[model samples]
Target: MVRSILIFVITYALFLISGFLFQIDQSWYDALNKPAWTPAGGTIGMIWSILFACIAASITIIDRKAGGLNNLKPAFWIILIVNYLSNQLFSFFQFSQKNLGLATIDCAIVAISAIILTVFALNIRKIAGILLVPYVLWTSFATFLSFMFYSMNL
Candidate 1:
């Protein structure tokens, strides 16, 4: 149980590093012509926090079921790393670079890779895959939001 808790904390912290590194440009973001349905910054942040927890849980489940992280297949590691990198890149593209188009593309990659990761996870552990459902749904929503931002700003 202690090991599982450690895994969750470490994974979640890794996910959050992107947010810390590439914070939202509040002034510029606030000036954008966002859709009426756009969520508040606080709401988005909360949602991400929840989603990251889910992701961490999913990883921990997979790691436990596979005996250990090192025991997991190379393919699983590849997909997981790809998803993590793409997910982190979204903040850089959207906030740091202030490139909505790149952000939109990055979101699409995040969504697609998340689906792949979930599927791969299901093959290893059903509960692990199930834990990722919210992450998948949220990333899909975020992809649409990114596209909206791109189009609205352009």
Candidate 2:
């Protein structure tokens, strides 16, 4: 039980660290042409917090179900880590570098990774897969938004 809690805490911490490291330049972002449907700044943060919590919970469940990370297949670890990193990279591309094209591509990869992770999680536990649905949906929407931003800004 303690180990599961540690996994959740660690995963959540990594997400928070990633966010802290790659922050948006609000002034620059405000200048960009965004869709009417784009979420407000506070809403984006709230959404991410909820999504990150879900991710942590999912990871904890998976770790517990699989009897720890060591027992799981290497592919599972690869998918999880890759998904996390790619998701973070979207922020780097969009906010840090202000490269909409690369951000769009990053979002597309994140969306795909979410789907892959969800499918893999389903094989392990149903709830684990279900938890990833929001992440997948959000990334898909972000991909579309990124593409729109790229098209309009270019």
Q: State how far residue 81 of model 1 sits from its true place (Å).
A: 0.6
Best by TM-score: 1
Residue-by-residue lDDT tens digits, candidate 2, 84-138: 8888888888888999999999889989989999998889999999998999999
What pairs collide in candidate 1? none
TM-score, predicted candidate 1 vs. hidden true structure = 0.97
lDDT of 2 at 88: 85
Q: How far is candidate 1 from the true structure (C-alpha RMSD, Å)?
A: 0.8
Query: What C-alpha lDDT does candidate 1 achieve relative to the native structure?
Result: 0.93
For each of the candidates, the C-alpha root-mean-square deviation to the true structure, in angstroms, is 0.8, 0.9
TM-score of each: 0.97, 0.96
* lDDT tens readout by residue for model 1, 59-125: 9998899889999888889988999999999999999999999999999999999999999988889
The reply for model 2, stretches above 4 Å from the true place, is none
What 10-residue stretch in candidate 1 is worst by lDDT? 72-81
lDDT, model 1, position 57: 94
